[model samples]
Target: MTDESAAPVSSGRRGRSGGGADARRAARTATTITQAGFIRRAIKPYEPFTDEQLQLIEDNAEIVLQETGIDFYEDEEAVQMWKDAGATVTQGNEPRRFRLRFPKGLVRSLIKTAPREYVQHARNPANNVTIGGNNTVFAPVYGPPFIRNLDEGRRYATIEDFRNFAKLVYMLPSLHHAGGTLCEPVDVPVPKRHLDMIYSHIKYNDKPFMSSVTSGERAADSVAMCELLFGKDFVDQNCVMTSLINANSPMVWDGVMLGALKVLARANQACVISPFIVAGAMSPVSTVGTLTQLLAEASVGIAFTQLCRPGAPVVFGTFAASMSMQSGAPTFGTPEPAFVTFGAAQLARRMGVPFRSGGGLCGSKIPDAQAAYESANTLWPTLLSGVNFCLHAAGWLEGGLASGYEKLIMDADQLTMFQKFAEGVDFSENGQAMDAIREVGPGSHYLGSAHTQANFQTAFWRSSLADNNSFEQWQDEGSKDIVVRANAKWKQMLRDYEAPALDPGIDQSLQDFIAQRKAVLPDSMS
Candidate 1:
């Protein structure tokens, strides 16, 4: 995660007197909360692996576990815990690395401890979402160093930019979650930025958001803040936060990530065990080979979560993009990656866990033809592959080096189309409209029919930015490209955004918590 958004741009709301510092402040506090994000109901999912192949992969994964084993580096208790759970654990050739060899069925049984599905609660109860089962939840991009837009060109992200993104995520009805590390705020110190980031999520958006994974302390901060906002009793009893913990490819789970996992799991929160793979560099180049590694890595990571606290909600995530051999840069939204994602989802479903896919990933340098083409390609397959949790759902650009303002709006518009399609067609009697068909008769227009008139608004999705006018009319309206329109769209959203209503007392408590943490932790330049 690298970048952050810019300062809140000019919005439609202005103070009573006119444009000035005080007016800007008044406009910033405009309070409006829309309904929680909509979910994608069941779309018949595509199964890439047949029963025979699925069984083969499972058997192969077991052998891989028996042979290569898994390294639980820097966590001695974890190694002994694995031994206690009936797995063969031994110290690695190097320091602090312990390799675990699971019994034939031990790994699978451990994964079974995870629930089939669970709820991820938001500060606003309305934005709470279900992960797994029949729901498809969309979350925004995570982790980038740079921010890009029409006005700024390219620059480092700051806290102001970060807050602006949270506000936008709150205001935009199309996005499901506010997401984590929407972009890295380099301006903030590394050890302390997480505090600012979590505060931004709490203050700007009432939607569900992710916690930082920089360390166990950072993760604890996430939990402490939640306690202040939602109360300790509620936090302990409910899964109020979900965070991402990426596994080092080739079957290694590092210490920092494991620490965060421990904190989140013991708190009864959720974590997505994602294997960060770029085929040929991190894993074998072949899609099948890459998926095998993805599965093996996810298996052990999920098992660790169960060790932390059995029955902790967990998601099996796959990020199997490829790397360009010539430049060593990552490639996204390509066929190899798609195949890996499809196969991974099949495996996760086989294990009965919620599955995640990198949402709308693309390698395009700009939000141009390449970006749209690649993003659309990725989104369609991700939806069809039965992805339960979609991260990087919108605004991912330049191989995740930066987050784009226009790209977020464009990807969101495309998401609307996919969301509609994922809901599939209705089969009810009224939906079938046999009476309307009979009444209309042969060759008659349905446009003026009773059924059409009654269901017009709800029947079809209306695109916010699509230009559907006739050629002459569109020309008369001034021909515009997708870029120009997307730029205008995002800016207008920022302008119109109002902070969702947050209770003053709870808000103050959160502020005090952050201040106390900062005072003790002093700025570490690392």
Candidate 2:
């Protein structure tokens, strides 16, 4: 478990003291923007819904919003905000249940204020990406309470495991954002875990990362740390940090999540106004009905963000999936979620904000046949579904209960195929290959031809983990399976990991800010 080669850069002390030859070299050693597996496909992914269906979904969603109204629970500030934004607000007799119906054209007008596409700036400028339109950006797994692997089985995740995952995210080129909660590092105290998690992300990866949503204070700490990493003024101007703010499904927004939502939105950071719903449980089991609720809920959350501050960035996030009625357990990678993915994304486009969904999601206990089959099903459509920001791009298993190290590598390998798929086809002179075709003339091998020699290196999508050897040759290589190979690959990645560099002063200040905030907050768990 000890990795001396790429020991995590100390959050307490990283980077050189000042500008010099040494500092410049250190900066170069840091992971620069090496492609984040996104392809701006000339040919867009195949969308499922037709004009009539799209109209039905949108019309019904607007009906839900304007008539029944969405709930804004337990927060007077939010209630007043909604009321001020032209919603008819009223409190239910029950505690924490507030309902407000929007005017017919309100949500649409609110959505129009948001940009159709906007750039999410990274600490390393070259890593910046446009989050809407044809672009699809991949991000690592978010919340998981445990870590799982063939060797480790299942256990509460530790700081060590979290750091290793961050290193893996740093090394992996497919993942665009080094997500906020790779897992809940239970080893770190709950009250202070955000400090360590945020520090690990800030120090280990130069890619654009997420902010803390555990509490308003933690969320504030994330902004402060961001301000330290990128300057306070620069961050205020650019959309740097994106946070997940989930609406408690069956129509409610919790106080704590709203706290983070407000802080991130007001500062001009982005929020994925997601509703973490199970279709059969928290929502109506029928696909059309569920889509209606999904859109309505997102409309309310998006309206809330604009209420927080007009022109703030938001993603119309969809996490609705079905449940196995037999066991009452959550299900993923099924036809229902795939249905939800395409439908929800279509709805997101209609609403005109960017969307986020389709992670490497599944409900399987281990990285077995079930896990591979389920995850692959979801991933293929994710590229085609017009998902703008793909969260949980890797390392997810057991229905988001655990972050499997081996699964992370395997899922990333899947992303390579989709990134290629997203690129569609090329028909330029070389791609058309008229001359090469004429030379070959429909017969003999192209292996030795001038075309093959010229394009061989770039012709194929190569996988580092998938085995292509014959059975006899495979047995000679220890008869390894995917999980076995993945184990070795992740360990080697950690061994090769170098903590991406930062300016020394920025590094020190980030650490200092974390320390100062930790000092003030009581060491208490929520």
Most accurate candidate by TM-score: 2
Q: Which residue pairs collide, candidate 2?
A: 395-408
**lDDT for every model?**
0.82, 0.82
lDDT of 2 by residue, 385-427 (tens): 8888989879989889899999999988888877877777878
lDDT of each residue in 1-526, candidate 1, tens digit only: 2223222222211111233554356445656566535665666788877889877778888888998888888877778778998989877888999888888888888888899899988876778899998778888889988877766777887777787677777776668888999999988888889999998888777788899998999999999888777778878878878789999888898889998999999998999999999999999988778877788889988988998899999999987689999999988778888888888988888899999985888898788889988888888778889888899989888988888888888888888887888778889998999989998999888999999999998898877777888999888877977777888987887776666545555655667888888888857668
Which regions of candidate 2 deviate over 4 angstroms? 1-22, 28-33
Off by over 4 Å in 1: 1-32, 36-40
